[model samples]
Target chain A: MTVLDIPSGIPAHVDTPAPGDPRLARLSLNQRTTANWDLREAVEGAVAAGLPAIGLWREPVAEVGVDVARRIVDDAGLRVSSLCRGGFFTASDRAERTRAHEDNLRALDEAAGLGTKALVLVPGGLPAGDKDLAGARARAAEAIAALVPAAVVRGVTLGIEPMNPIYAADRGVISTLAQALDIAEQFAPHEVGVVVDTFHLWWEPGVYAQIARAGERIVSYQVCDWITPLPADSLLARGMMGDGHVDFPAFTRAVAAAGYTGDVEVEIFHADVWAAPGDQVIATMARRYVELVQPHL
Target chain B: MTVLDIPSGIPAHVDTPAPGDPRLARLSLNQRTTANWDLREAVEGAVAAGLPAIGLWREPVAEVGVDVARRIVDDAGLRVSSLCRGGFFTASDRAERTRAHEDNLRALDEAAGLGTKALVLVPGGLPAGDKDLAGARARAAEAIAALVPAAVVRGVTLGIEPMNPIYAADRGVISTLAQALDIAEQFAPHEVGVVVDTFHLWWEPGVYAQIARAGERIVSYQVCDWITPLPADSLLARGMMGDGHVDFPAFTRAVAAAGYTGDVEVEIFHADVWAAPGDQVIATMARRYVELVQPHL
Candidate 1:
């Protein structure tokens, strides 16, 4: 009678995979989940909570100065799964794109400085004042090409995060995980791939196939929930786990089944969730992750 | 500099194709774009604006009566691309689902009666109090199975409209065109397919490929722009063409290239756009269609 045990064989369950394999414990937390905090505080908080790894953000690193970012991370014995992001390559002019690439170069430096494994990339949104999707994508590609060598030299894999099309106008132009994979496939496997964030891709149908395609290129897996009445801004309003409709367990299984051997990171975008006491949010996250996401494993 | 020119290897514009070539003109506008009218008024407005087809909402039809809805469409030389909608199958009990099926049966009858080529199905959002996406989807698929046969008997195609994930809790469980197609493909081609509404799907990364795969099965293509700072309620604030971020012309071309020769209709979901004078809205629509989408032709 349980929802997961439908007798009809329709496969509606989110919790189909049996967990308890040691891999289940490898889940990490993307530090941006607490983007409001300073780098060292995030590291200390995450370490206190026993999260295995942390995805670091760039701004805070810069705010505290890169040297401090590196020291605090090292001092805490924390692992940097990825540097927050780089690559807002789509722009109306060449100079802007070049600037984006330059910024990415520094981001790569930051990632390398912090010993991050990958530099997450969001290939800018629809170019400002431009209506050409294809052209903007080309610009983004060129920018990435410019940044790839630095990334390679730094030993930081590029994690391309294709935002949902809702952001096609002002955010990253790479709008689907599949599109990221397509671009990544053209490069060396370790050179580029994707960071699949459930919040951005929960609405996509080809998600399963894309994740499978990403395989080794699947550098990061993130979790967040989609809430209704998108805030006027559309940047915030992310629901917590079990609050929205993503079939997380099913998604987790699909990711795991596709040979992903990385950490599972919960990265929420809700302002309210952020405003709550950090300790409370972290505790809730751990509980919900286990209660809802764990069953799938 | 044009976004449309991205990866220019593919055709930059949509092909209008020959009349009767269902592949070229696949989109159908929901007269709600002219928010101030009944079915008769919408049909007349659509024709005067030079659009070939429309999706008729039930409110308008009820106000004018089916015969009138049928007559206005016929007199104005507009194709009834689809009925406003039918579905919301997820329920707290069997009786609720039965009621939903009955309602869909009525919608199918109206679609047939109105001479529309298809019935647009907006599967109900989360059952009044459930967070189970898989369950709601299963219920919807089951409802479709029950209703598709009747739709076929009436020579009407069923177009499942996958709303954006924002509506998963209140408006629809089928939240992506690809998921709809998967369910649609499971049934006879003549009975089930999908409606690709840009307002709902523009955010999806798989929109392009799904439309291509849809080919003749793409029963409807509606358009509306996503206005950021989404309204407090999900239903209102959809932008009119040329006002928001959807790459309308490109989408039109992609659907056309895939071999859909249906009518190209604009479906806007904006309160402001809807609140404006009907004539002014139509003029803007006509202008946008000509400047943006029609150019591809």
Candidate 2:
């Protein structure tokens, strides 16, 4: 049995299960869920809600120096679940690709500093005016392979997140978990893995099989519901869990069966959720995560 | 070598190939490209442009009465390349599914009456408020199996078209050419086949291999460019060929190598294209088809 690698900060009391509440112990609130919350506030918010971990985004971590951000999460007694992002590695131009490599190295340092082993990578979309999807995908795979050594040195697992195919043009090209695993498989699971996000993948057929194939390579399992009449910009329509069409029970169960004993980061990206008070959002996220997803986990 | 299936209506003068124009001979103007044109007008337009065939939609065909529509094309010496669509087999309810089956029966009759051997099928998306994508897909497969008998009797090949993943929720459940081929493989190639549309499938990885895998089961090959910064409603933003990012040369070459010797239907759905004068739209479509796609074919 793979034991859940609990991150840095869980108070002694919280570590001991609270009567029948073992499921809540795995919850992590991704900072972007409350978009307006700064690093300190988000850490405090997760702590107040008894969430064991907090997923950090680069923007928030950078706002307060990385060291300060680390200190804030450490002080609040919350472990970092995973870093928000660290990719855009689909450029053919040598100069542009080198710049991306430089940016990824800094992202690795930030992830290591934040005390999270997982750095979620969103391999970028088509290069400007380039119509060769096959070529772009080839470049992304090469970039990931190239970054593996640097990622390993920092003790950070590069979690390649295969985004929705809808974003295959402007946002990302890795649009299926199988595709992500194909790239991640080239490296040791500890060096490179995948982030299984429900919102981006619910429509995919054979996802459960792919999840099983992901196995130890699943570095993180993020949850967010997919609501329809998708926003004109589908990227911003990720709904709160249980508020949309995703079947949480099936998803959480599949992840658990795959032996993923890690934080269930609730990473919603919706405008309405962003507008709500951070505390309220955290509370709602925690409640829904427990009610809708916890039983299956 | 599979001989190119040239449909009727080539004027004797046009049949004798002009130097360097053998590839353009297979072009079929899908009526939707000139959305303002009725059956008679579309037939006239195709003849005026020296085109041999027209792809008709059921709605416009129904308006003229299928018999009249067939007569119009026949009298104008034009052949019906393929019927627009006839599938929505994702419904879980028995009664709704039965209705879809009935509609498909009528569609087969229309295709037979119009003298087209192919019927394009856009399997419907998720049932209302349902999240079981796997279940919906299974239902679609079953529905296709059930319809095969009727389709066979009418000598109409059902061409299952895999739509873009972006439309997986509300428009179609089959999101890749591989998925469509999986369903099509169960029946004889003449009984069931697949539609290869560049607009709906350009972003897919390994598409060329899938096209080759499609082989003789490729009932129809449709072309429409995928323009980005997609309109609020993406369904209506399909650009004219060469106006978007699709690499037509590669797609056409792959289809040709697969031995698909049938009509290449220009099927743009853009609002701007729809609003243009029918003759002008047909003129532009013919030009783009020749300039951007014919060479590879």
Which candidate wins on TM-score?
A: 2
Q: Evaluated against the true chain A, what TM-score does chain A of model 2 have?
A: 0.92
Tens digit of per-residue lDDT, candidate 2, span A1-297: 222211111122212223236566889989898889888888887877778889999998999899999999888888899998989988879899999999999999999988899999999988877888888889988888888999999999999999887788777888899889988888899999999999878877789999999999999999998776776656677887766678899988999999998999999888777877787677667667767777788
Model 1 segments beyond 4 Å from truth?
A: A1-29, A259-261, A294-297, B1-29, B36-54, B71-79, B90-94, B126-142, B165-190, B201-213, B227-232, B255-262, B295-297
The C-alpha local distance difference test score for the whole of candidate 2 amounts to 0.84
B235, model 2: CA deviation in Å?
A: 2.3
Q: After superposition, how far is residue A261 of candidate 2 from its true place, in Å?
A: 0.8
Q: Which stretches of candidate 2 lie over 4 Å from their true place?
A: A1-23, B1-23
Candidate 1 has a TM-score of 0.82
Q: After superposition, how far is residue A171 of candidate 2 from its true place, in Å?
A: 1.8
Query: lDDT values of the candidates?
Result: 0.73, 0.84
DockQ for each candidate?
0.33, 0.46
Q: Model 1: per-residue lDDT, tens digit, B7-99?
A: 112222332233344332434557777777877677766555556677788878988888877887888777787788787788869998888
